[model samples]
Target: MALSFLSHCLIGLCALSLFAWAEKECRYLPGDSGWPSIDDWSGLNDTVQGRLIATIPQASVCNSLPYGNYNSTACAELRASWTEAETYVTRPAEMMNPYYQNQSCDPFVTEKPCELGNYAVYSVNVTGQEDVLAAIRFAKEKNVRLVIKSTGHDYNGKSTGKGALSLWMHSLKTLQIIQAYESDTYSGPAVKIGPGIIAGEAYEALANVGYRIVGGECASVALAGGYTSGGGHSMLNTAYGMAADGALEWEIVTAQGEYLVATPQENADLYWALSGGGGGTYGVVLSMTTKIHPDGFISSGALQFTLAGAPNESSFWEAVRLFFEQMPSLVSDRNSLQLEIENNTFDVFGITLPDQNISAVQPLVAPYLEELTRLNISYTFTTNFSATYLDYFASIMGPLPYGPYPPTEIWNNRLVPRSVVLNSTANNLLIDAFKLAVADGTFLVGCNGINVADNEQRKHPDNAVFPAWRDAIASCSLTAFWDFDAALEVNLAVKETLVSVYTPAIEAATPGSGVYLNEIDPWYEGDWKQEMYGVNYHRLLDIKHKYDPDSLFYGHFAVGSDEFTVDGSGRLCKI
Candidate 1:
């Protein structure tokens, strides 16, 4: 009788496993029985006013195996223009990071057959709020995976998904300036910008009106989308605050297909979450209204130097250490620095000082210059002044390069707290970690001395920006790139070094600190929730559930993404 009972228990366990497998839930994919039929797609296209598009990989134009449109001349032009930011700007499925696309249609891989791989299967050209609503309702009704894209400038593959329906929001370019916008906690001039407005366009438009707003340093980053939602840092961050800090209201379409305005007073939770909680989580944003500051004369500085020889290696690090030490004082003076260290070269692209003159910058750099001279290091330094932020941006920031050709690059970032910079022992550890990190990839650092925690009026307590930013003196990113046609192991090895070696080194030096969500490693093996949102993750998750209970909008590493897993076939399935 006992043997019979044991056999019965084993049989029941096997039956339960089969039942679980049979009950697994996954979003519909092409070729699946549940996938929308051609008629269903045609109906959705009509609903969206014929803006629904069957996605063809942007690089397909260069490949004969994929869509058979290959022409040698066109392929050459496509390869030439591939690295330009504008190449992917208007393309519905193109993304900055091609690793997520599974190299399906890489322009450079002519030996392999080009396939759609992981690019969205379909997309809706979002021209208006109605389009956004139509896409949302269609995806929900059909149980199709949905994703959002604006400018395609995302770093962690948030804008693109495999076998999904994408809402391409690049054409909604509306910009309206409110000269005297009034709100509950503030009253000021604000600009209402469409989700499609890139940083450069917004800067130029605001400058034309004799005003400026905190925006991304990258010219192609969309102002109202993931940039702001990720707590965007800017050259003006030290002077004002983060990009999210300037936001006053958001016009969005919810998962339930309702159009609503989220502000400090109404849909308050949604407003707070959308402000800094990662984008593509809560709702589809249509436009964002943000506070604008009067345009003023801006002063900037640039410096560059290289390791003269092997003998100067120690001195080079010493100079970098000295520069890191001065970060606190620079922040105290409302100055921002963008520095890059790579291949034995150090470049300070710009030190932005708004509403000030070159004279004000001279004093701040005197100590660093003195150290460099003492170390017998040669360097180049220059300073300039501009009448408006746009002029300053044009001269100092310039257009950023778009790619590591087929887009095989990854970044890992950490926020260096003020305490770490102030502590001598900790500072040396941080510098040593920088050395180890730069050995594998480029090390980029942004030092902004703004204390958002102190500026309670500008950054509300409820805002979802990682709390670490409040105490951070600098932000550091270690980026690794590989050849476009490199083997899978090569890419995996690079990711391993970043995740296992560099990330831990930085974290050890700055314990309890968090990373910038916008720039973190997508394959990070750490406590991402704590690292990205800190103590705010719980609240953000709660809000995410409240607004999107079914988790319709999914992005890698976004809030509430843990509930689903991408299966072998690239289908998003509940875990």
Candidate 2:
């Protein structure tokens, strides 16, 4: 805080302190003191009175992130806050929340791995918007950086900034149906949503009214940030485009401590930017008004494929080929499909509106199915009906946790096309890697989703987001789950194996293929700037100028890039 502000309000606080038996969370060093210094633990007693500290020590989650002296100073100052509070951990355990806390920390020291490179949160979980505002204001006044997190699903750990305060937004979820179009008002219905609502809540709310919105595939992903920030694709994308297209307006809290609204008509730049700009670019979103579709039950199903037990053996690779060829035929906006490959099985998912059917979809997808059958691939199809978005999202995306803590670990990811199966040459390469990775337990999880096409304003000139891929099909996500200590080696191994398997094929099949920034991989050998945003990068920079002229909202994925840092090797630097 400013000297004047500190002298005025914090003098008493500096003299007071709090003591609590050590919890896993307390072990985490705070990012900034929010005060100049502290004399003893008793000084902070009042601040942590009701707060429950964890008994276990948190594990470190990230392996590599640019770190330097600035980080050291931040941690040192933050630790001083507890010193003034006279707080000490009497019983040091291993960790806190399983979903949010790092599961793998070194046993010797309670200090977070932030010293290595990664955010070790100060305090998290504010009561509400007011609490949120207070935290932001205090951080700014204190010259402390911050990271905003709702569900903490960010693979890069961007949800938590190193040596900073994390404003956990999960409790902020409040879904209100502001306006349900009257009988005479329109051809469609729409509703207002809170910034914290998840895809499951909004989906069910709208679906109950007899309509649906293209929302998150994961039931637990936050609707406003996680879902809309990336072009939301689901079994519905073939029908509704993406979650952002349904959005009409947005309420955001910018970095400068100002609350503002962005819409297609007002603050158009910001509205466009958030649609698919990829998360963490501009400001924390408060709420959004999105259009809802006509209501009806949806029929979704899964088709399981198995290789012909050629004397107890079916060529899993050939079975996969037949599945890819089947993709083009199944492009109905009413239908969505995903193929998951694991060592044990090949799971084919097919979801469509109730009115659409397996029989109706057969012709569209028949050719590929025929190829699979020709290979003696055995298959079975199963499905059911759902009247609510919750039911549908649950059936489709399944339940990925939206957690209580800002993420403690770093997980890397990539987005790729089905070009791996486009031809014989590529197929051969992909099949080999798939077999090896699965056998070695390297390719743990593989999931795919459809992308919205260009027709629904996806090509809006103002938005420099998702690169345009005409008639684009799907994005395969290669991911790994590991502890902080194991994260570095595991994440890298999965990434390298995935790239090694596909890069050659992607190059041979679709040279200069576009990339999706939302599914970014730092090492992917593609034109990142061009493939990620296309021509939108320039216009977005321009738009960022208008909406956030002073660049107060620069920490997240803001528009302008020039102001950020760079190192001697020509690598862009991170704060």
lDDT of each: 0.81, 0.52
TM-score of each: 0.93, 0.71
> What is the C-alpha lDDT profile of model 1 across 1-575, one tens digit per residue?
99999999999999987765643478877887678899999999999989988987767777777578878887888877776677887688787775675567877777787787778888899999889888888888888889999987777788887778999998989999999999788788999999888888888888888998898767877889998999998888877778887888999988888889999899999999988999889989999999899999988788888887324789998888888877787666557888887758788877888899879887878788888888888899888889998888877556432212233357778889988878888999988888887763344433434445455334443688788888888777776664565765677677787788778988999998988898877778778888898788898999988888888888888998889888888888887
Question: Candidate 2, overall lDDT?
Answer: 0.52
Candidate 1 clashes: the total is 1
Any runs in candidate 2 off by more than 4 Å, and if so which?
A: 1-120, 123-136, 178-187, 307-315, 357-366, 387-389, 396-439, 444-451, 454-465, 483-510, 521-527, 549-575
Question: How well does candidate 2 match the true structure in TM-score terms?
Answer: 0.71
Model 2 over residues 346-371: C-alpha lDDT tens digits? 78765465455435544555576666
